[model samples]
Target: MPLLAADNLSLERGGRQLFRDLSFKVFPGQLVQIEGANGAGKTSLIRILAGLSRYGYEGRVSRSGAMLYLGHHSAVKALLTPRENLAWHVSGEADFSDRDIEHALARVGLYGYEDVPSHALSAGQHRRVNLARLYLSQSPLWILDEPYTAIDVTGVGELETLFAQHARAGGAVLLTSHQAMAVDYPVSRLDLTAGIAS
Candidate 1:
């Protein structure tokens, strides 16, 4: 079974159809990239797949396992430390220990900054704090919307390695990134702009 399947998916916003009859699937050990020009509804499509969409759409979305989502904006609490934010964001079947959380933080290069409030961190650091949750997730499907925002070169490389590792381990990732990936695994792209009506 596919990790995620979208059958005849159609979404409308402000009475205009953003995408129509779009069908796709993310299988195990695969990386599916969602791409589009601005206003092509990339974020909307990601939200629908992540099950966080507010607007109704026509389609059937099937998931074989749990999904983790990272949005374009960092969801960290300004007043909370990175440790606290990661603790609140970690979920799913796997339980994360404090050591696991610290390891995740270190993986994201936040070694000495774990206890610092997120508001004090730079924009990229804040993003890293939010992304640390990915290390603790065991979800088979990851829905990421513009996950590269505010990340530096090193962080981007680390994330690409992380995604590649996930795919190699039979997990799947669905993400939107304007920057071309350098992952070792194969990546298939779904371009929303190709089907959108101009």
Candidate 2:
């Protein structure tokens, strides 16, 4: 069975029909992209899928294992040092530890700044901290919104590598990004403007 399946989904906001008749399924090790212009309801769709909304969806979305949702805003605490922030997340439910945090940061070029407060870090650096969860999540499904924002070229490259590894390991991913992906992996896109992709 597919890891996740959504059938005839729909969502609305402020009485406006954000989207309708959406459907898709994700299998283990598959990478899916949700594409749409601004205001086309990509984020709303994710919110529905993540169960962040109490109601409004028209269809069922079933999944196995767990799913992690990462939004545009960094979940990092600005007042806390990078190590402290990362540790808290790890302890609070993330599947990584200090070593994993350090390794992830290093891979994203944030080495040597582990002890500094997130507020002291540049926007891009702060963004990197939020991304460290990608390595820490161990969840079978990742629902990320514009994860490439503020990340440098190398960081994006690392994300491509991460995606490859995750899919190979039978984890699934669903993401939305304006930029194109660099990996050779086959991606099935759901384009909202066209009213849900095939």
Candidate 3:
């Protein structure tokens, strides 16, 4: 069964129609990438699919299971440490233990900076702290918007590997990234420009 599906989605902003009659499905074990040029409504569509934007859009989005969504912003609090951020995530997806949070932070290359204030971290580091949620998430579906924005080359490679691993483990991922993905796994493309999913 598909983990998520969008039906007959249409959106208009500033008197411009971004897309119309757009539909797609993301099944388990599949990695889907949203492809489009700037101002093509990629982020807008992601927000719709992630249920972050409920108004001003004509669409029906359905999800069969839990999902983890990481948007364009890192969504980290500068006053909080990396450890605290994960422990008290605004999403309230799960109650993570100290060990679990620590392990996830280490996986994202924030091992020793776990307790450092986020304000002291670099932009990439802040993104790493947000990306750490991927390691800790048990959700079957992951929806990400521009996840590679502030990541380094090595970190990008790691994320690609992680996405592949998730697909192989019967999970699904839908993400938008300007950078081309370099991975062994097959990646399905949903080109908003053409309104095609293949």
Best by TM-score: 3
RMSD of each candidate relative to the true structure: 2.3, 1.8, 1.4
User: Cα deviation in Å at residue 72, candidate 1?
Assistant: 1.2
For candidate 1, give the lDDT: 0.89
Per-residue C-alpha lDDT of model 1 across residues 1-198, encoded as one tens digit per residue: 799988899999998888999998889999888888888889999888888899999998888988888999999999999999898888444678889999999999999999998889999999999899888888888999888899889888999999999999999999998878888878898889896321
Which regions of candidate 2 are displaced past 4 Å? 93-97
Where model 3 places Cα greater than 4 Å from the true spot, the runs are none
Give one digit per residue, the lDDT tens place, for model 2 in 1-198: 787888988887788887887788888988888888899988788877777866667888888788888887788889998777767766766556568889867767778999998889988888887787677776888889889999878878889889878998999888988877888787778889898565
Q: How many steric overlaps are in each model, in order?
A: 0, 0, 0
**Ten-residue segment with the worst summed lDDT in candidate 2?**
89-98
lDDT per model vs. reference = 0.89, 0.82, 0.91
Q: Choose 2 or 3, whichever is better by TM-score.
A: 3
Model 1: how far residue 6 lies from native, Å: 0.3
Query: Model 3: how large is the Cα RMSD against the reference?
Result: 1.4
lDDT score for residue 167 of model 3: 97
Q: Which portions of model 1 miss their true places by more than 4 Å? A: 91-93, 196-198
Cα lDDT tens digits for candidate 3, 1-198: 899999999999999999999988899999999998999999999999998885599879999999899989998999999999888773487767798999999998999999999999999999999999999888999999999988888989999999999999999999998777898999999888888988
TM-score of 3: 0.96
| Clashes by residue pair, model 1 | none
